[model samples]
Target: MTDDKSKRDFRDRNRVAGDEEYEVGYFASKFGLSIPQVRELIARHGNDREALEREAKALGVR
Candidate 1:
């Protein structure tokens, strides 16, 4: 469990570029949400790259 958590953590700080556009799933893992939950939240009170970085700073995900 711990390892899975950390593995996702590792994925967050440095986002995967090119092919894999950094997604809500990435943020969800960082924030302990289910993928569907993350997608839903994004759908609710929207934010993309700039907002996502702002959120990450607030949450201190890195």
Candidate 2:
């Protein structure tokens, strides 16, 4: 029997990966904010996905 765990989508959606440039870029685009803004949110919120999202919304996505 072969283990097919590699096919699983193991990404943790509850946390933002600050070190991943693509992840940060995607998050920024999703909120219509700049990469720097998302990065700053990650830094302040410690990558908590919901917190960053709330902060991003409070900042007013444009």
- Say which candidate scores most in lDDT: 2
Instruction: Give per-residue CA lDDT, model 2, range 1-62, as digits (tens).
Output: 33355777756778888888888999999889989889888878888888888998989844
TM-score per prediction, in order, is 0.40, 0.77
Scored against the true structure, residue 59 in model 2 reaches a CA lDDT of 91
Stretches > 4 Å off in candidate 1: 1-22, 48-62
| lDDT for 20 (candidate 2) | 81
| lDDT (CA) per prediction | 0.51, 0.84
TM-score of 1: 0.40
Candidate 2 lowest-lDDT run of ten: 1-10
Can you give the lDDT of residue 7 in candidate 1? Answer: 54
Candidate 1 local lDDT, 1-62, one digit each (tens): 12244354454444322223255557767767566655554554465555554564555454
lDDT of model number 1: 0.51
